[model samples]
Structures are given as C-alpha cells and as structure tokens.
Target: MNSFFSQPTLQLAQSLIGMELVHESKEGITSGIIVETEAYMGPEDRAAHSYGGRRTKRTEVMFDQPGSIYMYFIYGMHVCFNIVSGPPGKPEAVLIRALEPVSGIALMEKRRYSSWKRSPAQARKIMHLTSGPGKLCQAMGLGLELYGSKMNKGPVFLKENKKIPASMIEAGPRINVHYAGEAAEYPWRFWLRGSPYVSKS
Candidate 1:
C-alpha cells in the first residue's frame, strides 16, 4: 500500500488521474475513475497543511508512511480526502479533486442531494454529484474516520486501471489557494482533459 504512493507528490498526482477509487460499505460499493488531483509539496509548499514543518494531531498521519490517508475538515464543514505521498517525514499529499462515477451512482445521489425537496435536472445532477473534492467526499462517504488509514486495506481502496494518455492530461495552478503566495501559482494541479467530472475547467 505504501509502495503505491512512493513517488514524488507531483508524479503521484498525475499518475492517479486514471485510477479507480472504490468505497465499499453496507449501503453499497460506490466506485469512480479518478479524473482530477492537486499536489501539495510538503513543508516548502505554503498551500500544504504541513507547511513550515508544523506537526499536530491532525497532521501526524501526513508524516507517516506513504499511502496514508490525510482527511481534514474545512470552513467548519466538508471533509476533503488526501493521499499521503513522498517519503516519510516529508508530509507531501495529493488531494483528490474529482471523480467520474463508475458504479453505485444512485447511492451517491442519495448521499449527496437527497435532502432537496425537488429533484434537480438529470444532466445537472450528474455533473454536480462528484465534481469537487468536498462533493466527491460527501458522495462517496469519505470522512475523518478514514483518516490515517492505509490505502490498500478495508473500506476505501484505489484499484489499478488503464493509464490515461499524456495527450489527455492537463496541468495548471491549483484552485482556491491564493494565500499560498507564489506557491499558489505553481502548476501543481493535474486532470484529464475533456472530462466533465473535473472540478473546474
């Protein structure tokens, strides 16, 4: 499991673009093809939670072995899922941004937008379901409970899949990290080109 994430953070982020993220629970097995990811370059990256080599209860798993989960809350809500990468003590991670739903989509819809009184338009619902980090986490039922878990075991696991072609891959500055200063402009985000499931264009 840790070996799967032994690559540098940037390389792992790009390599994960075509893999399948599978979550199995009593509800059902909800799986999706990973289409978007963003890399945080350990302590030196201002956008990273472990920037400045800070250590805390929340970030301890990030300093553990590669392939560890590093989930955290934001804005007092929304759990974002990240995969710990790079070498131990380095604290780098790749944020899984978006997923193309592959199975159990109805379960995802039930988890995500079931509270709405009126059903949303079919096309819009599919696009909005797992199209963002928070949205995908909510849809796939990822939470703090999975934090520090290894990737290869149990409830959530990434399955190997066909590789995406370089021609279909794109990279750009990460989203919503303006406070990272110059690091905010670094092109560390990678995604599958022409994929509607990507968080943003």
Candidate 2:
C-alpha cells in the first residue's frame, strides 16, 4: 500500500472515497470497501473540537502528526475512529463512516453474530454490522487501545481499491452533528452511492 493517507485532511477525505480499510487482528485480516467518510477541518471549523485552537486532553491527540488515530467513546458506548490529518498543531481528521465487506466476511459474520446473537437476522445484514461509526469500529476491533496508532503502518490501515468508481462517490451532511450548530450543516460526509455498505444514505 502506498500510504494513500499521505494527503492533507480535505484531500484525504476526498481521496478516501474508494479506498479499502484493512485490519489484521487476532481474529484475522478483515477488509472492507470504504463507502462513507466525513472530514473535520482543523481549528476554525466549529464541528471539530480542535476548532478555535482549543486544546484539551481529548483534543490534544487531534493536533498530533497526521495519519494517527483519534478514537473516542460516545453515549457511554461506541468507539469512533478518526484519521488525524493536517500539520502539527492543526487538528484535522477524516471520520470513516461505512464500509462494504470485501475480505473476511466469514470472520465479520462470526464477530457480529456473537455480538448480536439475539437478533441473528440482523447479523446477516452486512450493513448493520458496519454502517455506523461505532458499528464499524466494533466490527473492525478498533478501540481506545488503538488510540495514537499509525494508520500508514499499523495492523489497520487504508489502501487503494480501484474497483470503486469516481461516479459512485457522493458527498453529504455528517450524521448526528446537530450539536455543532451551523457546522452540523457542513456537507463533509462522503459515500459511495447506492452501495449496500453505505448507512441509510
């Protein structure tokens, strides 16, 4: 993989449109066709915690070197993973939203099946397993333990997948960001149109 993540935040956000997110974990190497993503521009962007150059314990990592992982928990559950971008001191990142199962479908099925055995039918639905940020992280085994991990050369990273087409790419508003005020309206979300892996887009 040629470190497709080398680009700047916004460029990476756009370039990641058709990339593949691969994870080599104890369970096995599970790969997914990235279908959705959202960009958070550094500082000035209210939607980004690093906005206004506000640096806190949580936001500190966002200002670190680009290509680092910035993961956080929400709703007392759900771990969201973001790829840190932009130069040092500038907090920016791209939030991976959805992914289409490519390799290791069986392993994903097993993990999701174990997690949602009560609703096995839902487990059969691939989108349900990785459509949302939390679901994607859970399916990929990403967590706080992976915080600060390098995306360019880690067990998990992104690679180019030419199977995806530019025409299939689409952009829209990010999910659940009303708390960001006007920033919530920013159409930073990008996705592969009509892809089964795409969350209710």
Candidate 3:
C-alpha cells in the first residue's frame, strides 16, 4: 500500500492535488481526475467534529488509525466519504469534492442514471455526473459499508497523475458551511482551475 495517503493531513491534502479517484463497481472500474478537495483537521477545526471534540459512535472511526475511511450520511439521504489522515487520535481527512470523468465514462453515466431519473443527455448536462460530494459518492457507489476501509490496497484508491501547474490550481472557502461560523471562512478548498467537473467555480 502506498504510504503517501497515510501521511499528515496537510501533506495528503497537497499531495492529492494531482491524482485520480478510481472506483470499481459491478458496472466496471470507472476513474476520474480529482479536481477539487477540502481538508478538515481534527477537533480544533470548527468546521469539523459535529460535537466539537466529543467523540460518539458515529465519529469514533475518525479517531481510528490513519488511512481509514470516515463515511457519514447527510440530508437523511446522501453518503459523504472521507479518507482519514494524520496520526492516530488526531482526526483529519480530505474530502473529495469533484472529479473529471476520465475512464469508464459509460459506467459512470449508467450508475448516475440509476440514482436520478434523468435521460442520458440530461444526466450528462444537468447532473454533473461526479461533481458534488454526494453525487461523487453516488456515482462511485460509496456508503457506510466503505467506512473504516483502507483505500490504498482496496478497489478504490488515489493514483498519481501528471503534476498540475500552480496556475491551474485555485483555493477557496468550502461550500455549505454557513453553520461553521469563522471556520467557514477558512480557504481550505482547493480545485483545478477551469475544470468543468468542479461543482462550483
């Protein structure tokens, strides 16, 4: 298993700048170039820890060994997945926000179709296929079952790609974090510039 993913939170966040998110499902192994991500660092990060350092059964996995998966349900529906980083006892993770469809586009299209009732063309146009956090997880077939799973040696993991130039990368505040107060202002979100796959510009 590659240790790059097991590094510190900030390192993983920056190293993942140019990588691919490969998803293997019954449909096939669909891959996408990672275009956007956000880092949530431990209890101190007000944007993280719903209980603010209070660990519950749901968040217990976050305190597990690094490289574990931390998946949670939101909006009573969607599953958002994150890869835990940093040392044990220090909860930190990188959120995969957007992906540019690279391989197995057809499979992605089909999986996305099953989730939302949209025509192929409309799915490709209006839906963004693998854009939003929830949409990305849906298209990748990720859920609680994948929580605490290791991605480095599993069916899903990050793979290296050609280095994206600095000019092509941009940073901004995370989305839908109004409740985080000052933490919402943190510019932890990073994305590829001019990438159509980005959920938001």
Candidate 4:
C-alpha cells in the first residue's frame, strides 16, 4: 500500500480511481471509491498553489513526503482534500475530486444535510452525496484538523478496492482553474469513464 504513492503525480491521479478512501469516526465508518482526481504539479504549473515554488504556511504540507495529506480550505467555507505525491521535496499533489459512496450512505447523507436546512430546490440526491470535493469532505467528516497527516495514519486511510482498467479512465482540464491561463488547458484531471459521481465541471 505504501509503494502506491511512489508513482508520478499524473499516474497517481489516475491510479487512485477505484481505490476506496475510508474515514472511521465516532459517527461511524464512511468509505467511497475514488472516481475523479486532478493533478497539480508545482513550480511550473500555474494552476498549482505551489506555483513558482511558493511555499507558505498553507502549502507547507505539499513539500512533505508522498502520501502525506495536504488538505486546504477553499472559498473560505469548504475544505478540499489533496494527497501529496512527492519526491520528498517537490510540491505536487492529487486533489480528490469526487467519490462513489459505498459505505455509510445514511450517515453521509445525514452529515451532509444535517448541518443546514435541506433546501428543496437543491434536490440533493444520493448520487450527489459525495459527488464533489467539498461535498465528499463534509460527508466523510474530513476537515483541516487532519491537515499534514499521513494517509495511513489516524482514522482516515485508503483501502485497495479493485483495479481500474486503463481504458475506463479519462483525462480532461481541471475544474475551476480558468485563472491559470494556459495551464488551465492542461489535461490533468482524471476520472473513471461513465461515472455519475464525477464532479460536473
């Protein structure tokens, strides 16, 4: 399982598909098969937070060893989870974009909607329970508190689920990265082909 992170960032992003990302908490255990991911290569990729080798307190974890968790806050309200895919000093990561929930659906739905009123207009469906980055974190109980932690440590970790055929995977431009200029066109985002849980970009 540890050797899995040794792959290149682009490969890691695609390889993550079909693997089960699990989080065990007091609430219960919630797990999902990774269906979509986006790779961010730093220093050169303008879409990356570590572009030009910029390292601040928020991005410090990106420089850590491979498999280190590099979670961050986004839009001042949502938490996004990234897995460091590094060669020790390099700042590259794979953002977990979406997941297909396979365990604790009831709990996930509860965690996802219990916090606020379920607006009828939202039309929240089980397929959308963990369809996006922020939604997955909220459903799985992931937060900034787990920042910088190793993937195999604590209550959250990945379990090998099944192997995804290469033909069943596809790549495209990352979502919400138009500000990256030319980098926005890079086909760094990977997803399971025909997966309904993939984020709608």
Candidate 5:
C-alpha cells in the first residue's frame, strides 16, 4: 500500500478520496471511506509545516518514505492526521480531511459523544461522526501513539476500495490556511461531490 502513495502530492491527495481508512483496537474496529483531502506541497509551499526545509522532531516524519503517518496537534487540542507522500526527503503529505463512516457506527458514536447515549433518531446523524479530520481521528482511536506508524500495516491503515471517478471529484483552495499568503490560493483540496461527510463543502 505504500506504493499507492508514491505519486505527486496533488495526485495522491486526489487519489485518496473514496479509499477506506480502517482502525483496529481492543475496543473495536472503526472504518470509513475517505471523502475529502488536502495536499501540502512541502518546502516551497508556505502552507506546509515542512516549508522552508524546517525540520524538527515532529516534522521529521514527513521526510520519511511514502505512506508514513504524520499526525500532529493543532489549536492546542485537535489532532490532524496526514499521510507522507512523494519520494523520500521530499516532505510532501496529504491531509485526510473527512471520511464517510463505514463500519462500527456504535463504537464511533461512543467515542465522539461524552455520554455515549443518544436516541435512535439523533443517532441517524452519522455523518457528524467522522465528518472532519479531528473528529475522525478521535472516533477511530488515533492519537500521538499512532504517529509515525507505517500506513501499509498497523492498527490504523488504508485499505483498497472502489475507485472514484474523476468527474465526481471537486477541487478548491485549502481551508484555514490564510496565513500562506499567495500560496493559500492554490487549489490543492479535493473532495467528493455531494458527500455529507466532507469536512467542508
């Protein structure tokens, strides 16, 4: 599966849409089909954490081989998951922005909600379970412990799924990266059309 990510940053980001992300744990198994993604062009792109060749303990994993997990904490709270992309030392990565919950809905709701108690009608809003990057990470039991894990094998990994057609994919500028100046205008974000699970439309 590592080879799956060995492509150009933008290409890999678009390709990830519709693939399945699965997690296994003592609690249960949780899975989702990826529906949205954003690419960080690295080095030259001001939006990238590895921009300007900034290498720290945290950013080091982005320089690893393709398919390495690059999880990070943001806003002093939320955890965002990224998959290392491109060749070794390139530092490019694809941010998994949203997912459509596919399996273990109950376990996901338990993890997402404080009380794990909800009416059947209220529970129907399953799209909210894994609708965003941080939410999906929490629902799937992913955290710093899974950082740097190989995506090809682990409690957390990507699985093959039905291919998404090019026509169904929508591309636009990345979200919440206004600080990137001109780079913020780059159309690196991709998502499935009409997917309620997308982090943003």
Candidate 6:
C-alpha cells in the first residue's frame, strides 16, 4: 500500500501478461512473454510467504524493493520465481506462473531438455517449453543463485512488449494453495485468455 509498487500486486500481475522476461545466460539469451501470474498480498493473504508478518532468511527478499528477484526451491527439485512487490518493509510478491516462449527458443530447449536437436514432431509441441513456473525457470536457466538479486541489474530482466487489453485477461484462484483456508478462494491469479502456454486454463 505505497508508491514504490507503481500499482497494487493484483494490478501488476495483470499488467505483466504481455511483458517479456529475458535471461542472459552462459548458454545464450532466452526470453518469454509472461502469460500468467498470481499475486500474494503482503502479510494478510494466507497464501503469501510473508503472511502474518513472518520473516526469515528465505523470505527476506520479499521485504525489499519492488523489483527484487525472489526465487525459492520447492518439491525438492523445482525452483519457482517471484517478483517482490509492495514497498520496502511491506512483504508481498507476484509469482510468474507461466510464460510463452518468444526468443532463443532453441537455447531454451537446450537448457530444459539438454538437447535443442529435436525431431520435427517434437519441435511442434512447444507448449511444454515455458508453460509453468518450474518449467520456465529451467528453460531460462533461473535458479537459487539469483535469489535476492535485482531483476534490472543482473542476468534476468523484464521489459515491456505490448499491452494486453482488459478483455483478453482472466482472473481466478491461484493454483495449489488449497490449505490456505478461505484465502484459497481469492481470485488472485491472472492469465491471458485462451493462451495455450498457460499452465492451467
């Protein structure tokens, strides 16, 4: 609830639908069009890591500036990325749920599948490239190494591409937060309508 955010977490999530998230990595650059996002309101939303003002080493970056990269390991094997939101002292973030590959797709395939050399049929099934958080992180070479870093000052950066009109966006409850009590029903997830690259719906 401050000026540094530019807008609320929910609004920011919706606005990111058409923006490009680019990664300059050792293999090469890979970029994607953000097609789905979910916002976790600071301290109050049960689904948020900072809910009830809980703060720890891993959750610290969520209290930083709006553009800090918040990456965390989950399910023992996957990494999920989030953009810290809300102003300093207020912990909130927007989770990038899914992306649509836009550039360096071969390199993305290399990173994710360890082989860009795919059969003609394999190449056509590109929806799995960046359709989910963990999948996109692997495709873009994002990991825990970039945790707590500034998005605009490192290998990862986001840029505006084009605006997705309001009519093309949809909102719904976030994925996999069924244990968050009544908060599970909060319609905080936003995604481009009819985007096949979205993880769900």
Instruction: Using TM-score, give the best candidate's number.
Output: 4
Rank the candidate models, highest lDDT first.
Answer: 4, 1, 5, 6, 2, 3
lDDT of 6 by residue, 1-201 (tens): 224345678888887889999999887899999999999997889988899999999899998999889999999989999998877888989999899999999887777776445653454468998999999998888999999988778899887788789999999999999889999999999999999999954
RMSD of 2: 2.1
Question: What does candidate 5's lDDT look like per residue over 116-180, in tens digits?
Answer: 45654454478788888899998887898878988858888778899899999999999999999
lDDT of each: 0.91, 0.81, 0.78, 0.92, 0.89, 0.87
Model 1 RMSD vs true structure: 1.7
Candidate 5 vs 6: which has more TM-score? 5
Supply the global lDDT for candidate 3. Answer: 0.78
Q: How many residue pairs clash in each candidate?
A: 0, 0, 0, 0, 0, 0
lDDT string, candidate 4, 1-201, tens digits:
777897999999988999999999999999999999999998899999999999999989999989999889999899999999979889999999999999999999889887765565575788889999999999999989999999887888899887999999999999999999999999999999999999985
Clash pairs, candidate 1, are none
- lDDT: which candidate is best? 4
Q: Candidates' TM-scores?
A: 0.94, 0.90, 0.90, 0.96, 0.94, 0.92
> Worst 10-residue stretch by lDDT in candidate 6?
115-124
Looking at model 1, residue 87 earns an lDDT score of: 89
Tell me which of candidates 3 and 5 scores higher on TM-score. 5
Model 6 clash count equals 0
Per-residue accuracy of model 2 over 1-201 as CA lDDT, tens digit each: 334555777768878877888999988988887788999987778788788898887888888888889998889977898988888778898988888878887787677677663755542666687887888888887778888888867798877768655677787788887888888888888888887777773
1-201: candidate 1 lDDT, tens digit per residue: 566699878889998999999999789999999999999987899999999998999889989998999999998879999999988889899999999999899999889877656755544568788999999999999989999998878799988899898888999999999999999999999999989889964
Instruction: After superposing candidate 2 on the true structure, give the runs of residues whose Cα lies further than 4 Å from its correct spot.
Output: 1-6, 121-123, 163-165
Could you give the C-alpha RMSD of every candidate to the true structure, in order shown?
Answer: 1.7, 2.1, 2.2, 1.3, 2.3, 3.0
Cα-based RMSD of candidate 5 = 2.3
The list of candidate 5 runs beyond 4 A from truth reads 115-124
Scored by Cα lDDT, where does model 4 land? 0.92
Question: Which portions of model 3 miss their true places by more than 4 Å?
Answer: 118-123
Which segments of candidate 1 are over 4 A away from where they belong? 117-124
Compared to the true structure, candidate 3 yields what TM-score? 0.90
